[model samples]
Target: MSRVYLSLGSNINPKHNIREGIATLNLRFGQMQLSPIIESEPVGFIGDPFINLITTLETELPISELSSQLRLIEYDFGREDNAPKFSGRTLDIDIVLVDQLEGEHFGLTLPRKDLFEHGYMLYPLSLMEPELIPPGQEKTVQELWQQFPFPEQKLWLTEL
Candidate 1:
């Protein structure tokens, strides 16, 4: 089985969406390792604040199939494919890292760029998989997280 790390977030009915989303992922992917959920102000859009976290699961599906599966879950919770990139979401799930594979696969950059850009994503990732080394990175997630400029952003630990 391939180990996969995913970032999950929601702003629209965030608490309900996040809990249900976690249940669904657990059912579909078997056991999962979860980080502490975080509540944060939305990025690049004016809307309700979002709750975000990282989860690690083991799956036999390839990258494309895993992406497709996650999309299906998002769709079930009202995600619209045509929605603006920065719009509020019922649920948003993205692959952060899958095994050690690098480069573009199914149009996704390995270790999605948002993983590096967002404190909400990176902090939880570091909590869940502190030792992870994404492709092209010489430092572990924990190490990179230490250097991240998070003071410019606001994120709070939240309970689901």
Candidate 2:
């Protein structure tokens, strides 16, 4: 089984969506390691705050199949394909890392760029898997997080 890490976020009805999203993932992938939910302002657009978290699961499925499954989950929760790139979301789930594999798999980049670009993504990941070494990177997630400008991005842990 490959260890897969995913990032989930929601702005609209975040509490409900996040709970349902987690439940769905658990049902599909069995038990998962979850990070504390964190609330952060939307990036690249003006919208409501988003609740974000990272989850780790073990799956035997290939990246293509796993990605397809996640898209279905987001769609079931009311995600719109036509929505603007940085617009509000009912539920957003993205693959972050799949083991220590690098390069493109299933047409998606391993170790997503957002892993380092956004505090909302990096912080929760570091909390869950501090020693995780992202693909093609030498530093652990915790180490990268240490250099993150937390103050520059407004985010706080939520009670979800």
Candidate 3:
């Protein structure tokens, strides 16, 4: 089985949606190692704050199939079909890391670029797997977090 780390977030009806997303993922993927859900301001657009987290699960499916299932799960939770980037979402799930695979596989990029750029992605990732070094990156997630460039970007652990 391949170990995969997933990034999940929601802003629209955030509390309920985040819970539902986690439950659905648990049902679909079996038990998971979940990071604390965190609250953060929307990154690209003006909107209500979002709650986010990272989850790790073991899967027998290949990267492509796992990625497909995640998108379908988002759709089941009311994610808009053609939502603009930076728009509100009921659920947003991405494959942030998949084992040690690098570059693109089956049309998806491993170690998603967002992991390096977004606090929502990196912070929880650090919590879950501080020692994991994403493909082509020399530093661990904790190291990345320590040197995270955006001093102003912050994340708060939520009760949810």
Candidate 4:
């Protein structure tokens, strides 16, 4: 088994989508420690703010299998297949990291490059694993959160 962190989001029926996403994830992968939800203005799309959350869990499935499962959850939750890039959606689930291990498979890499660059991922990540230090980075999640420059977007716990 490996400790994997996932990022989930929705701009459409966000609250409901988040709740359903959590339930689906738990049912498929067992227990999880969820971080708080964040309501942030759409990054590239102009629309309602998005509700984003992060969760860390242990899974026996391989990284590729886990990614596939998450993709299925998103599709099952009503995500569109041919939506405009970065446009608001019914759901988005990303495999943020898989422990400290980093390797390439099927032309994709674990610990997504944006994971260390975007506050969207780091903010919620800090809530669940404050002390986790990204590989090749000197800062912890909490430390990175402190240094990240994303504007003051609302972040809080939601009824789950």
The 0-to-1 C-alpha lDDT of every candidate, in the order given, reads: 0.91, 0.92, 0.89, 0.80
C-alpha RMSD in Å of predicted model 2 compared with the true structure? 1.1
TM-score, one value per model = 0.95, 0.96, 0.96, 0.90
- Model 4, 1-160: lDDT tens digits are 8888888888899888888888888898887998877777776667987888888889888777888888888889877778787798788998878888776754557677767766678888888789989776788989988887765544455544
Q: Could you give candidate 2's per-residue lDDT for residues 3-46 as a string of tens digits?
A: 99899999999999999999999999999999988999999998
The TM-score obtained by model 2 is: 0.96
Q: For model 2, which pairs clash? A: none
Error of 1 at 140 (Å): 1.5
**Best to worst by lDDT, what's the order?**
2, 1, 3, 4
| Candidate 3 accuracy as lDDT | 0.89
Error of 3 at 93 (Å): 0.6
* Cα TM-score of candidate 3: 0.96
Candidate 4 pairs with clashing backbones: none
The per-prediction CA RMSD against the true structure, in angstroms, equals: 1.1, 1.1, 1.0, 1.9
TM-score rank, highest first?
A: 2, 3, 1, 4
Clashes of 3: 0
Q: Which stretches of candidate 4 lie over 4 Å from their true place?
A: 152-160
